[model samples]
Structure formats: C-alpha cells, structure tokens
Target: MTTQVVILAAGMGSRLGRSLPKPLTELSDGRTIMQQQFDNIHHAFGKRAKVTVVVGYKLEHIVEAFPDASFVYNEQYDQTNTSKSLLRALQASQPGGVLWMNGDVVFDPRVLDRAAEMIARDQSFVTVNTAKVSDEEVKYTTSAEGYIQKLSKTVKGGLGEAVGINYISAADKAMLVRHLQRVDAQDYFERGIELAIEQNRILVEPVDISDLYAVEVDFAEDLDRANLFV
Candidate 1:
C-alpha cells in the first residue's frame, strides 16, 4: 500500500505576517518550507508516498507551487482550526495509516528516518522534542504505560513539546476522525488526540527527536532558528 501523507497548509498564518502561505515562505536555502517537507517525505518513503495538502488561504499559490501534489480545500479555514483541516484530510484519505505535519515545520529529513520503524509497525505516534518545552507550544505527558496521556498547550508537568509531526495507524484513524469532529472549531488537532486517548484508550507513543532539528516557524525568531538548521 502507498504511504499516505497530509500537510495541513490551510491556516492564514497571520503570526508569520507573510503574504504567501507559510509553507511557501522561502528559506535561507531557497527551498520553501513545503519543498523541504516534500524532499524529506520522498527521501523517507520514495515513490510510495502519496501526499495530499489541505489548502485554504491563498490556496492558488500553493497549488501552483506544487503541481504534483493532491489537495483538499478547507472552505472554513478562516473560521476553523487544524482540527477541521485535519478532519477533512482524514475524510479524504483511503483506509490506511497517515503521516501528517504542520506546514510551517522545517526539520531534518532524518526525523522521518527515525519514524520509519514506528510507521512500519503500524503504530500511532507523535514526534517530540524533549530538549525544550515552551509554554506556547503543544506539550505532552505519558501514561504509566509510556503511551501519550495528556496532549495540549496546558498540559501540566509536560514531558516535552510535540513537534507537529504525527501519525495515525489505520486501526486508530476512524476513532481519531470521530474525536476530531467532537472538538471545538477553535481547538487544535491535539485536542482530538487527547479525547481519543481519554475516551477510547488509543495508544499513541511519543517518538523523541530531540537530537534532530524540527522547528515550526510561527514568529520571526522561530524562522531564524529554523534557518540555522537548514
């Protein structure tokens, strides 16, 4: 089966203050953030990867930049959050596992190489950076069994920060979709993952990638930090 991948690029990204979609923002290396993500995906999965980007704000810009990618438009992008965008992508996907990342994240391709083992085992996971846990970023804590328990911005005693790279196995995809629907429109996709763990007992492991560079570019400072890695 082909490896399904989704890039959530519909948000207006007002924080970044860029006219183009955040993913299209040019990096120091001249490759856009989305371009680096595509290169990483291809390097990790080769021709087996089927990428679907969820587009909205300035959708045409992204559409023109990556002509080969499949897309799903989120009409309510301005009114909704990642939960809705991710929900749409999941709905459009075939009955299989999916690997997704926030469009603005610029990371070392080796991050995906680290995740390849978990993907092969069909396990659900969230890539994390244990080196830092900022109050603004999504954080998480694991259950006694070492599976992710609490996952959100307000998680107390957070073990690490979720780096916006995640996977949902085929077995857990439907449940995640149902939880995504239940979350509020303003809620991040992490809320749905929390609900799934709380209600359905889905096991989501935290794959630590602190040794690797994975930065989600939201502010100018973040872009600066990400550029250092690239």
Candidate 2:
C-alpha cells in the first residue's frame, strides 16, 4: 500500500527550554528528532511515501535540514496547538494513507514498518502503539477491547503513552480533519484524536511495542529519559 507521512513539527518544546525548534533537538545518536522520524518512514514505505511536514517554531531549521520535503507553515502555531497544525496539511495530502505523528518523540525505526503494515492491512483502521514509560506517568486510557477512550496525559491511569504515530486512511481523513476543526483552535492533536473517538468512528489497533517508548519532551528531564529508549 502506498503511504504518505504527516509529521506535526510545530512544538515549542517548553519542556526542553531550548531556543531552537523541537525538530532540531538531537537524540543520543545525534540525529535531529524530526530527521529520525522522517528517515524511519522513508525506510519503511520507501519512496512511495511522500512526507508532508507541518512546521513552526523555527521553520527554517526544518527547511534547511530536509530541502526536498513538502512543508506547511502554521503561522498560528504559537496560538494554536497540535490539532490546527495537523489540519493545515490536509490541503496538500495525496491519495494514500498518512502516517501521522508528532515531532517530539523517539522510537525505533522498525516501529514505522509495524505502523505502516497495520494500516495497509486494516482498511481505514487506526493503529496506536503501547508506550513504555515509568510507573507514575499518566497513560492514555482505553477499553478492554483496546479502543482509545481518553488520552489524559495530564491525568493518571493511562494504558500507554501515544507513540505519536498513527495510520490515517483516506476514507477517514475528512472526518479526522473536520473533527480537528471543532477542537479548540488552541487544542493539540491528542485532543483532536480523543474527539474522533467520541464520534464513534475511531478504532484503536494496539501494537505490542514496549521496546519503543515515547517521550513527549515536556521537560528537559524527559530528554534524558528519551535517550534511554533510543
């Protein structure tokens, strides 16, 4: 199946307290966070996957790093959250499924292959990987059947941290985009996804992806923790 990648790269990374864009932040291996994600998808889907990046907070950093990829700048990035940044990419989306993810995460490159394969086989399915985190961290809640119930990253009792990667099918893109529009113009992507579940059209395909932990990079300490995963 042909696939496209949509990476939400507008994060300010208040957690990291860095002046540079979050996408420019490097992991233990010295690859920028966004570069790691972009290359991972490139490896998984090959050239068949054209990537669309939604960027802000040092757009030039990303532009200079990957000159060939499509970039959608969100001028409202500082005011809005991840949801609006995501919707901005819809204008240029191609006809294939999109591998959606946030830019502030670290994961094994193999995770992209697992996510892409799940989407191709499920037919409009949404696959979210289980996160590996400390015991006290808030987890996204889900039903016994694995459908995402609530993504209360701030609250306690989540089943897993969102891996920042999902396979959104073409058939479902419209709904996802519209749902995002209704979100507080300031809401982030996580809120948009939770709203999609409320619409009853969302399904959660959980992968046994404990080897890959997600770091939202909310705090500088989170960066150190992220290094442990990669």
Which structure among the candidates has the greatest lDDT?
1
What is the C-alpha local distance difference test score of each model? Answer: 0.96, 0.72
- Tens-place lDDT per residue, model 2, 125-222, is 33344545445443477677766677645736656665566766666677778888888987666676677777855765555566655566667787
TM-score of 2: 0.86
lDDT of 1 by residue, 1-230 (tens): 78999999999999999899999999999999999999999999996699999999999999999999999999999999999999999999998899999999999999999888899999999999999889988999998899999999998899999999999999999999999998999999999999999999999999999999999999999999999989
Give the range of the ten consecutive residues with the poorest summed lDDT in model 2. 122-131
List TM-scores for all candidates, in order. Answer: 0.99, 0.86
Query: What is candidate 1's local distance difference test score?
Result: 0.96
Model 1: lDDT of residue 139: 97
Error (Å) of candidate 1 at residue 18 is 1.1
